[model samples]
Target: MTQINRRDFIKLTGASAALVAVPSVLKAEIGSAYEARVVVVGGGFAGATLAKYLCLWGDANIQVTMIDKNPNHVSCILSNLILNDRLNMNDITLPYTSLQDNYGVIVRQGLVTDVTGDDVKIVHLDDGDTITCDYVVLAPGIEFIDVPGLKEGAANNFDVVPHAWIAGPQTELLRDQLHSMQQGDTFVMTVPQSPYRCPPGPYERACVVADYIKRVNDGDGHVIVLDPHPEVTIEKETFEQAFNGIYKDIVNYVPNATLQSIEINPGEKIAKTTAGDYAGKVLNVIPTHKSGKIVEDLGLLPVGARFAPVDSASYESTIRPGIFIIGDANDSGQPKSGHMANSQAKVGADAIIRMIASKSSSVDFVHDPARLEKIRTNSACYSPITYDEASFLTAVFAYETTNNSMKLVQDSFASSNSPHWNKDNFEDMFIWSESLFSNSFT
Candidate 1:
């Protein structure tokens, strides 16, 4: 096997092509004995990356405490491989040891109950522990909206219809269920409304499951996809080809199948929706997602909005200047993917360092003309259409002074052609995903 490194990843991801990296070390240089504390609320791709870079780029005065419910983060990126048996939980599990040992970031394992304060922030934990800080970043990722009939089903039985979206024990349950498929058994899955965590994720899951079933059953099992959207969400042509061309006999793609309720039973599950009731041996129903619980509990979300709105240049909450939201929680009009979250963390980290380095605790520094021009972010993701074939997409966005928001650069947008889905791209997917996992966590 060929060895791939982070340098190769930067070139493939193309985030550096738009100059997204800002030198926070420069911010560290101009500070005296001024000390600042940053408390990050979650330790996924967004919060962990912010905490690690804050200590690495900021001066010794930068003290960061990361509070997460778990000591390790199981990445949703490359998790599809787990269903196909190419990878396992250990491969995607990232610990906080490096952040603590190498960068001096304090990793606190607890659930954040409430966050209060204006100039200074106080993070309240469920265990009655509170951490005071100069700035607080909310990167709790996402939470799912309850389906009409899921609560009762879950109460009666555990994980009857496993979504496996967050990628942990639920993921293992879903995989084990897939492994139990008989020769003619059926697997049914749903795609929630748009603006969910990952745009291409549902379709990718369908393909991976179909591929696995074909291999084990010799093309006897059936795979059904129920998507509410009009058509494919992202990389339309590529996924359409995979569904219709490669796995047509085993896969069935149904559009505009709005999910209404679900009925769980001992041997089979049925999804009741506008399209019709689908009876299958296994069910994976991913509900519509919203910002993390903390964002909604703290009243950061605007009226009738699912996510919190923030200034794209710095990712600082418009509702609360000193409080920042990154990853799937923020409404920045960016794709909610791991690569994008890592990029947004860099922008947020740089802005926070600059604020403290100025020797002023005021939050108005984000409006400076020079600071806005330096704002740029990019995202790249590779989706596996089969167990050994993949497709990819890349996009770059820069802060537009006219709109006061980030806009996609038409020239920088690129996606792999449907015809290019081959073995080479499949190999690149593992390298790309592994590199991203290492770069953000390690």
Candidate 2:
């Protein structure tokens, strides 16, 4: 992976000047001879952010059509709060109305069956609609693989052992289950291996559920966290303190525990794992993930890889040009979080705008030094230790020209030190999420 610290990117690129000046210049030329139509698939963080930026940075002449299976995006960012009753589903939901009304983006509700074409892009929707465009940005989030004995549509399937990872109907189901836990009832959840969506997500969910059980159930509730990884993947110290210190009595942390299969029995949840058999009242199994079906169907992913390989600078697929992959679907070597996806979308949107204005015919716009220099992305995640307290971690990545990749900046790497959890951080988490929600949706 090639990268530099965020400061280095700022110093080399004149970041502020270029970001502020270049968009206006491109916006000025949008209607003249540089008009372009761009189709964005998936209405998650990456696609929504890219569509919003494409319209904001590129003037009215640039047409952006945003497509998704759902009418709006239900954010996974703070979905854990739903389980604890701290937040409702509507609290994190974002409608495409803002993107359509505010940014002049055309929001369409449909599934993209196929993305094809070379010079001129072609997107086929499941509803028998085909859209031709100059470029296509795909940010379809993630898809889960079938675990043994737990095929998605089986009679006793995910609806019972809800993953609640995608933050939709499943989220509500899990939230209701957690809310219904009685005193002394056990709640069990599994964490998949790394490189999955949201590195710290499983840990956060464990913390939130544990917190809810203790406070709401009068400390009589039990929370079991089964991990497939050796240990906590991200924010180790903070979550360690959470599990071992505060909720030690109520929470059981099992490391090196690989989930073999799940057999859901009424009021008797059984998970067969390498570690041991765990029985609980509620079971949440987050199975392994792969690139969204759209990207996989397009053959954009390398063999045996869960994500599409792309140029970090422009987010253009290494195998196919003119089609860019962002968010959790692409292997950009960045943390697969909403914040990182939003950051990559900005760089991607800018690159597409520049390419359109330059009249580039080829899909290889990533080799341009000027384009690579301006790419910078930062990711921050705040994990709730309790209902009222939270801990934070942050890192920055910049495009490194020498190796042509994105790397984490050593200096920008920061996390809350000892005594990481605090009420102030909890407050900041909401503010941060609101900013991201607005940037991507409104």
Candidate 3:
């Protein structure tokens, strides 16, 4: 693998200084004895990247504490490979050791229960501990909205069926279930509404599952995709070609097929859904999302919104100052994918560091001409059409000062042509992912 320097990393993420403006005066150059504390909740791509960049860019006066309930984060970036047996859990799991040992970031293992503050922020963890900070970043990723008739912890429940969206034991369980498929068995999966984790994820899963079934069962197997949206949400032409041409015989694409409920019996190896229930041998249901419990519990979400609304340039909560929300939990218009989250983290980290250096608690600094000049974030996704061929999409979101929201730059949107999947794109996927994984974790 070629070693990617910081500049290459920024370019690959599409968040270079030219694309996304940095404050004229950064924190590292403005050294001060005034210590500022930043407590980041959750250890996924967003939070971990924020913690890492904050430490790397901020001066010694900036102290960061990262808290995640789990010891390590299993990445959802390359998780689709789990279904095809192309990769295992270890390939995607990232630990926080480097953040603590190398960057002096304080890593804590605990669940945060509540957050309260007036000028400063106070985080209450479930373990009877409290964290006080000048700035609080909530990168808690996302939590799934429960569907009717499906219980998370019930015996032989969804876990047995496995969404595997978060990438962990559920991923392994779903992988094992796929392996047990018979020659003519069926694999059924549901796609949540748009604005879910990754737009191309469900279609990717469908393609890989169909590919696996075709390879193992001699093209006798079947795969079904039940999407609630009216059509493919992203990379429309690319996935349409894959479904209608490449794997047309084995793959069934159903749009506007919303999932209302589910019934499963592991013993019979059967599952049912409201969208014309079938006795598929395996089932995967990706659920709708809400901001993490920490955000909801703190009343950070706007009234009737599933995610916390934030300033696009700074990523600071529009409703709550001094509290920033990055990643999937924020209501930023960006896609809730790992790569996009990492991009948002950089923007958030820079804004936070600049805020502290100026000793300003309010996010009004985001409006300064220098700060607002070229705020943008890039989102790129690679969808595997088969085990060896893939297609990709890229979009750049620039902050519009008028409405104070991020909008897709018309000229910055591009995707691989339909029916153009190839080995080179597939190989580039690994290289891109390796760069992302290394940049975020280590």
**TM-scores, all models, native as reference:** 0.93, 0.92, 0.92
- What are the lDDT scores of the predictions, listed in order? 0.82, 0.83, 0.80
Please list all clashing residue pairs in model 2, or write none if there are none.
none
Superposed Cα deviation of residue 201, candidate 1 (Å): 0.8
Evaluation by lDDT, superior candidate among 1 and 2: 2
Query: Which lDDT tens digits does candidate 2 get at residues 25-76?
Result: 5466544457899999999998998998988888686899999999999999
Top of the candidates by lDDT: 2
Q: Report the lDDT of model 2 for residue 334.
A: 87
| Poorly placed runs, candidate 2 (over 4 Å) | 1-22, 25-32, 152-156
- Show where candidate 1 strays beyond 4 Å: 1-21, 152-158, 361-363
- Cα lDDT of model 1 by residue, 1-442, tens digit: 1122333544655333223445644554555555799999999989998898888778568899999999799989888889988899999899999889888999999999898888888899999999998899999999777777684422523367888999898889999999999899999999988899888899889989989988888889888999998898888888888889878998889898999989888899998888999989999998888899899899899888988999887788888778999989999998888888888988888778878878665546766777777677767777888778777776767888786788886666667773536676778777777667766777
* RMSD of each predicted structure: 3.5, 3.9, 3.8
Better of 1 and 3 by TM-score: 1
On TM-score, the candidate that comes out on top is 1
- How would you encode candidate 3's per-residue C-alpha lDDT over 1-442 as one tens digit per residue? 1233322443565333123434334643456646689999998988998898888878567899999999999999889998788987889989899998888889999999988877877899998899998888999988777676665422336666688888889899899999998988888888987688888889988989988988888888888888888888877777888889878998988887888777766543333444576558888878888898889888998777899999888899888788899999998888888888888998898888778877877788657876676677877677888989887766778878899888888767666663457776788788778778887888
Q: What ranking of all candidate models by lDDT puts the best one first? A: 2, 1, 3
Clashes of 2: 0
